[model samples]
Target: MAVHVAAIDFGTTYSGYAFSVSAPETDLKDVEILSNQIWNSGTAEVASLKTPTCLLLSKDRKISAFGYEAEEQYADIVLDGDTEDYYFFHRFKMNLHNNKNITMTMVLEDVRGQPLPAIDVFSLSIKALKDHLKSTVEIKNIKLDDRKTKWVLTVPAIWTDTAKQFMRKSAEKAGIPRDRLTIALEPESASIYCQTFPSAGCRDIVEIESRYMVVDLGGGTIDVTVHEKIPNGTLKEVTKASGMVVAGLRLMMHLSNFSFAYLADHF
Candidate 1:
């Protein structure tokens, strides 16, 4: 049986999945990203390769929408002034990063100030993504089977053991078996992606044997890594992964607030 490689980036502000059918060693160019790329960014519609990491749940805790659909539906609910009943969560992945002692019993606060079990919040989000990913695999003529596929899940490198374990269990609850899933560090993955497609603009500075730094600014966390190119076109980390784990999201929020304030003052 042939095994296909699939990766799910359950990010803080967005989440999406991609699969590669070709062998990484032999056929490296047959990777495909999903075309379901349009999203409603609250004010306007936008196209993106990934969906917003937002989830809308009914009063009874059943998921009503996810990703872009969740964003639009939640916005409509807010406009209708009935936002108190529905639990809408956006950028909630940071909760794990903030808490060092995460557990199944820990409570998570939704955007509406309502609380739910952290496990329920994370697991439901993962399940939603996994189901959508399964549909995409079927569309690509690859039947879903745990044994015949390898799953790669991305997580921030600075997350604690408790946080990582929570994500692992959430994946298991989302129908991804322990044997088929592997957790990858987000910064390392980004480094690999960059190396796979080095920018022509920086080729002169990033030539063979050159050392460069990677500053990964994710939705919830920021990480920096220094890599040295090897003779075989591979990169090795020369410095320890370092950076503030909770800086990117906070910085983005501040920037957005500043932009709004600037517009308000001018108008």
Candidate 2:
């Protein structure tokens, strides 16, 4: 019997999940990415399979919303002059990448400087994605069963053991069964997805045993990994992953500021 597999990419900038009824490895083309994945469904300002990793919480520390819904609800909260009574966080995943010494007591501050436990924020984010994924899977007429469903959660290849463990714990907290979960390196996941579809751009490349690099430019951090194609068509990490914690969103902010300054100086 074919098994179902789901992957939750808790990305720094965007978070989303993809599920396939049949095993991804059994038939590469069996994977079907869900459409209209998140909030602001028709707005041209925001269109994508995933939403920003932003989240909104109640004063009592409960998750009020997430993604574009979170953004919109937080804006409403601010307009009502209740920003202080709620927590709104955006692109906070970079905190883990930026802090090499992340501790249980470490806290993350919201846009209004409201503080909450980092683990709480992460678990809330993961929970949001997990709940949404379950809803979508059910909509596909597939009964959401842990026994039939296996999950792969991706993480940066260069993350420390502590960070990796934290993510595993967060996923467990989100209600994913420990036996159904697998921690996959981000680069390896990307490579596997790419390999599923044979591309003309890669047809001319040297055959098997070729080593290639995977460079991921995410919203919160950049990661690069080197992998070698093995005899079994599987990829093996050949070199240590390299990257930094600088936010990809920062580049857009800097460019926007520079453009505004130049326009003001000229006109």
Candidate 3:
């Protein structure tokens, strides 16, 4: 009996939310998905569907800002000579996977290498996105009843059950009811989305009986899934989901290391 479905994608490098409202009789392909596509980057000419994964905390540990606003706020804080007290975090989502021994008590370091409870950081970030989405729905004049809304959170398929549970706990701590939240695998979601394409646009690609692979090259992880379309218009996984940490962020780290090594050797 849900009136709308909202999905949050907490990416390593960026994060965003999307939602759709449709009648039960409406065609899946006809349902219009709306997302936060006007993320402000301070520069008037720069806007994107997702915002940078960043957070800024005040001296007392309260959330000051998030996303692009967090970056701009931290920059101003630095100029004001009060940067020491604030905590700024970016690209911290990878810590959940990088730490093989992740637990509820895990801690994550901020940009200054200062440690804070990982659960707190994650919950706060999720809360920010959740609040933003609520505000957007209100602005659109949509009557979104929290009790009647379905929330979906996406995670990398390669994540361990513990990591996935951690996300669930974080979402709950962020005020999302446990029963209302559904955890979805990134590549599987992609496959489902592909299924909605019209035959002419996706003929032989995702058509019935077609076999294909979905490679989700994300910021912190890369996931691959093979699927086969059944005659009933459903996709069945043909193989186990697998992935690695060698993705966009990791490549950037390698490039930075190479640059440093080159400078050390030449100068």
Top model number, TM-score? 3
User: How many residue pairs clash in all the candidates, one count each?
Assistant: 0, 0, 0
Worst 10 residues of 1 by lDDT: 28-37
The top-ranked prediction according to lDDT is 3
Estimate, for each residue in 1-267, the C-alpha lDDT of model 3 and write its tens digit. 435988999999899999988887788889899987589788545788999889898878788999999988876766666666888888878888888998999888775566889999999999899889989988988876666788999999999899999999999998888999999999989878877754565557566789888899998999998899998878889999998896667777556535533433343
Candidate 1: RMSD to truth = 5.1
Model 1 scores a C-alpha lDDT of 0.77
lDDT of model 2 at position 92: 73
Task: lDDT winner between 1 and 2, please give it.
Answer: 1
Give per-residue lDDT, candidate 3, residue 34. 93
Q: Candidate 2 residues 168-218, lDDT tens each?
A: 887887788889999998877778767766588764223579878789877
Instruction: For residue 149, give model 3's deviation from the true position in Å.
Output: 1.0
User: lDDT value for candidate 2?
Assistant: 0.75
Best-to-worst ranking by TM-score: 3, 2, 1
C-alpha lDDT values of all predictions: 0.77, 0.75, 0.84
